[model samples]
Target: MITAIVHIDVEADRIPEVAAQVAELPGVTEAYSTTGDVDIIAVVRVAQHDMLADVIADRVSKVSGVVRTRTYIAFQAYSQHDLEAAFALGLDD
Candidate 1:
């Protein structure tokens, strides 16, 4: 799966509305309202690289109140479980 983390900026009054709208789009796994440089963070997962453009530029970017967006393509995913497993590779216990 291809995962894209999208940082979204929206009109000041439309944060919730924008987040809800983005969350409903195809390929969007989740959309969160957050406190930071951006208003919303959307997680998008797709099967093909070209689907990114369809989801981000074509769908997400066109949502009402969406001012701008910055998308990050995930190269690797690390979790606490994965970290522990890696560290235990050569251990006896």
Candidate 2:
């Protein structure tokens, strides 16, 4: 699966509306309203790489209140257990 982390900016009054709209898109698995430089964060997952443009460009960017978006493609995913094991590797007693 291909995963993308999208940081979205939206009109001040439309954060909730835009988040909901983004979450409903086909490839978007989750959308959250957040505090910081960006107003919303969306998690997009698709079976193929080419589908990213279709989801992010064709769908997400067109949401009514979306002002802008920055996308990050994930190269690897590490679980909490994986992180712990890696850290413990050199600490064996």
Per-residue C-alpha lDDT of model 2 across residues 36-82, encoded as one tens digit per residue = 89999999999999999999999999999999999999999989998
Q: Which pairs of residues collide in model 2? A: none
Give the true-structure RMSD of model 1: 2.8
Report every candidate's CA lDDT.
0.96, 0.95
Give me the runs in candidate 1 sitting further than 4 Å from their true place. Answer: 81-93
Backbone Cα, N, C clashes tallied per candidate? 0, 0
State the lDDT of candidate 1 residue by residue for 37-85, as single tens digits.
Answer: 9899999999999999999999999999999999999999989998999
TM-scores vs. true structure, each candidate: 0.86, 0.85
Measured on C-alpha atoms, candidate 2 has an lDDT of: 0.95
Indicate which candidate wins on lDDT: 1
